[model samples]
Target: MSGIYIHIPFCKQACHYCNFHFSTSLRLKDEMINAICKEITLRKNYLANNILNSIYFGGGTPSLMNADDLSKIFETINKYFQWSPESEITLEANPDDVDNKKLKIFKTYGINRLSIGIQSFFDADLKWMNRAHNSKEALDSIKVAQGEGFSNISIDLIYGSPTTSDDMWKKNIELALESDVPHISSYCLTVEEKTALFHQIQHKKTTAPDLERANIQFDALIKSLTSAGFDHYEISNFAKKHHIAIHNTNYWKGQSYLGIGPSAHSYNGQSRSWNVANNKKYIDSINKEILPIETEFLTPSIRYNEYIMTGLRTMWGVNSDEISVLGDMYRVHFLSNIVKEIDSGLVHICDDQYVLTERGKYFADRIAMNLFFVN
Candidate 1:
């Protein structure tokens, strides 16, 4: 089944570590929403008549949009596309946006899933990240969402920030578990080029992030979540049974999806496309009845690389049979090269597939890169 991803590229404030496309200005809010709705209709045929199984509201901060905005978008989707009664609808929100009133508004819409960005439950770390909410608000948001009867909820957390000690990291996980949320997405804090964090380290204004501490945090996360009976389905995601994010899973599995709004990407099996990242350009282009997107046709080598990269990161592993379907010379190259990896205890050979062991998961990208065809 296909999916839809709508990017709302605006935030109330910029975090020092963010490299995503967003503007702090709300002046363009109404114009942006109109552009997004126009985009939905403009790209309706991109899905190629596939029934949509998931609709994800992702962004600079989807929570920034009020209920009326969400209602109009949902209405447009229902009016234009084929949707299932049980389609998984998810909205990504920040903790500051999840009071009782807002949560009630969310429920009245068709949103069945809520992904709250609660980077950390410690005020010190929150301030370091320039988050809009404090520790109390983080917990309060979860309580209010739960109190409003939202069960399929997920919280995003960041680990290994300079401000997060090992004890504090454990506390953050414990706080999330204690909150009774069913899903959690924990990511290692990284310093991207041109980000404020990067500049700070370059200028010695702040200490560089500790890679060792980050690795330790990841190991601890695995141990703790496994003990808590959460399934480590993806590298950074843990969830109770039946609660893994459907939209993201579809992405990893290479299912077709249409992405609307600025800076969003779409894949329809054989080809991929992406809209312009500039907000004004996106709005102007769409207003002219032109879908401002670039297209790419995947070569076999590109598809193979993508498959290996995504497949080996999950518990499902990469199937040799699937690679074999790509044809013989390619299959021979893969099997022969994988021999060294298997000997190194980095990958295990199952009946007809190869999957990473725990240690291998840490070098997933490196391994996948090595397996890519050089031609």
Candidate 2:
């Protein structure tokens, strides 16, 4: 099954640590929406006509879009592509954008899932991140959505920020559990280049994130969520059984997907492409009936490395047998290199498949890097 992703590139304000492509200005919002619809028609074959199992409205803050705007985009998708009745339609919303009124609009537009960006439940952490919503709004929105009958919900949480104490972090987790949402995506705060957080750390205006604290919180998240009966299906994601995000899981399984809009990426199994990051440029090109994007075909080594990187991050570990599908040499090399890790208890053999141990998960990036196909 394939998926479609539409990026809405406008946000109310920039977060201190966000490097995502978005404009705080809505000057080009209408034009961008029109262009994205046109792009969907122009690139309808990107997923090779696979039935769409998921349609994700992600971005600067998709919840900012009105019902009519969302419906117009959905109409374009329905017209140009095959759709499944059971398809999961998700919208990423900021806490400030979610209210009873907006949630009703979302239901009317066929948005079956809500991925709320509730970074933290504390006002201090919200201020530190520059999130537009306050603590009350954060708590209120989720309850509002639930009150409006939206059961399929996911919330994002941020940990490891300077303002986040372990006590406060536990409260955030407790808040999520109390909200009774079935899914969560938790991330650690990181300083990315060109972000305000980066500049602040570089100028010593704020201290850099403490890796130790981050690790501690991550461990806390796992323990707490697991105790709450959440499945650790993938790194950074926890869900109740049958509530895993189909779109992200399809991505991890290397399924094809079409992405429409500026800065959106599309993959059709063998190659990947991304639209131009400039909003105006993308709008102009699509208005002229052109797909403004760049693409790269994957080499075997690149694909192999990707498999290891993504595979090991999931509960489903990297399979040595799957490497043989690439070629015998890849399988041989991976098995030989992973032997040491297996012996060290960083990885374990489960039913003939190699999966990362819980301890190994903390070092997932380092382990994946070591296993990269460097040739």
Candidate 3:
């Protein structure tokens, strides 16, 4: 099975911390929609003959698109590929854009899952993030989605914001639990380069996110969710039993997926490519029947590094057997290097997997790097 990720690159407002490729204007919305449809038709064979088990509409805000535009995109997919009836079709929406009218249209066109961007249920946090939605809408959207009979829901939350206190962070989790969404994707607020938040820090207009404070919040998040019967399947993600995000899980498992639209990425078994980040350039290229993408053939070392990086972040951990595929030298290097982590109680071998221990979760990236093959 494979997946498709469609990026809708327009947003009503620019969040202070977001660095994802997106435009704040809708002047080219219609043209962009057509370009996406064309891109889908052009890349139909990217997944070969695999059944599409997941279709995700992500981006600036997929909910921003009208039902007609979304339905047309669905039609294009149905024409080109084999879509599984049980496939998990997720649409990432902001709270402000959700409504009963839109919900019915989503159900009619087959959106079984919703990943709402409810970064916070507080007005101050929402304002700080420059989100288009307000507190009332944030609370209403989930109820509205449930009222419309959309069961599988995932909402995002951000932690460690300059304006968010620990008490507020706890309340945010409480709000999420109250909503009873089956899955959640939360993260420590990051100030990425070229974003408004980054510039604010650079100019000393705002202090940088406190790492120590963020760690405390992360620990609290794990404890809270774990006690509430949610699986900490991956860093920054938690879900109820059997309700994990399949699209993201597939990516971590090294499955092939074709990403469409500006700044989208695609990967097969051995190579990867990304479309141009420029909206107009992407549309122009598609109009000319060209894929404005940059490609790379993965080296064994790069692939090995990626496997270690991703595997260490999940509940599944890194499989030692899979490491042997890279070469006997890599296997030896892993065994030799992992002893220190094991001795330090950061990692342990279980069922042929070199999995991180509880304490190791916080330093997953650092541990993965230490185990990396330099040759």
Candidate 4:
């Protein structure tokens, strides 16, 4: 099944830790939406088959768009894209932008799933991250969405922040569970270059994230979620049975998708393309009838490396038989490389599938890299 992703590169405020392409100013919001719709029409045939199983509205902050703006974008999709009757349409939102009225508009536009960014259920943590929503707003937003009958929901939680302690982290987990959402995506705090958090660390205004505490919090996440009957489907994603995210799971499985708007990336199994991160440049090029994007044809080595990277992080693990598609030589290389890991009890064969053991999940990245093909 195919999927489509449309990036809305606008945010109401800049979070200190975020490095995603977005603008705090709304001066070009309308033009950006128009350009996005045009881009959709231009790249209508990107996916192999015209049938889509999902469409995800992701970005700096998709909820920052007004109801009218979102309506226009969805209208354009209906005008061109042919999706299944059961296609999962997801909108990523921030707590500050959610309310009963807007939630109703989301339903009207045929958005069936909501992924809310409620980083933490604490005002102190929110302020530390420079997020726009408070704890009260976070809780209220989920309630409002549920009240409006939007049940297929996911909420993002951030742990391991400097301001988050074990107690506060537990509270955040409890709060998310209380929201009764089927899915939760939690992540550790990282200081990427060019972010306000990075600057703060360099200037000594804030300390770097503590890896020890982060590891502890991650262990906490696994215990808490699994005990709560949530499947630890991926490194950062957990879901109730049969409620796995269609868009993200498809991406992890190497399925094709089309992405519209600035800074969005699209994959078609053998190649990938990404639009210019600059909004002005993206709009100008689209208006001039030029798609301002760069494309790359992934080599077998590159594709194998990517599959190993994404596959090892999920519950499904990498398919050993599918490795033949990469080439017999590469498949032999992968098998040889993973021998030590499998013997070390970090990875193991289950029936015919390979998956991470609970202990190895903590060091999945290191394990994946060890299996990467270098020529």
Please write out the lDDT profile of model 1 over residues 41-140, one tens digit for every residue: 8777778765889999998999888977988898888877877658888999988888887877877887889999999999999999988899998998
lDDT of each: 0.88, 0.90, 0.92, 0.91
Clashing pairs in 1: none
Per residue, candidate 4 scores C-alpha lDDT tens digits across 38-144 of: 99889887878778899999998898777779878878888777776589999999999998888888898889999999999999999999999999999999999
Reference-based lDDT, residue 187, model 1: 91
Alpha-carbon deviation at 102 in model 3, angstroms:
0.7
Q: Pick out the ten consecutive residues of candidate 3 with the lowest summed lDDT.
A: 44-53
Predicted structure 4, TM vs. truth: 0.98
Q: State in Å the error of residue 151, model 1.
A: 0.8
Q: Give candidate 4's whole-model lDDT.
A: 0.91
**TM-score, per-candidate, Cα-based:** 0.97, 0.98, 0.98, 0.98
- Please identify model 4 stretches exceeding 4 Å from their true place: none
How accurate locally is residue 54 in candidate 1, as Cα lDDT from 0 to 100? 95
The root-mean-square deviation over C-alpha atoms between each candidate and the true structure, in angstroms, is: 1.2, 0.9, 1.0, 0.9
lDDT of 2 by residue, 1-375 (tens): 889999999999999999999999999888888888888889877677668889999999998898768878988988977666578999999989998888989888778999999999999999989999999999999999999999999999999999999999999999999999999999988889999999999999988899999999999999999999999988899999889999998888788898888999998879999999999999999999988889999987888998998999898888887888888888888988898888888899888778888899899998888888898
Report clash pairs, candidate 3.
none
Candidate 4 backbone collisions, by pair: none
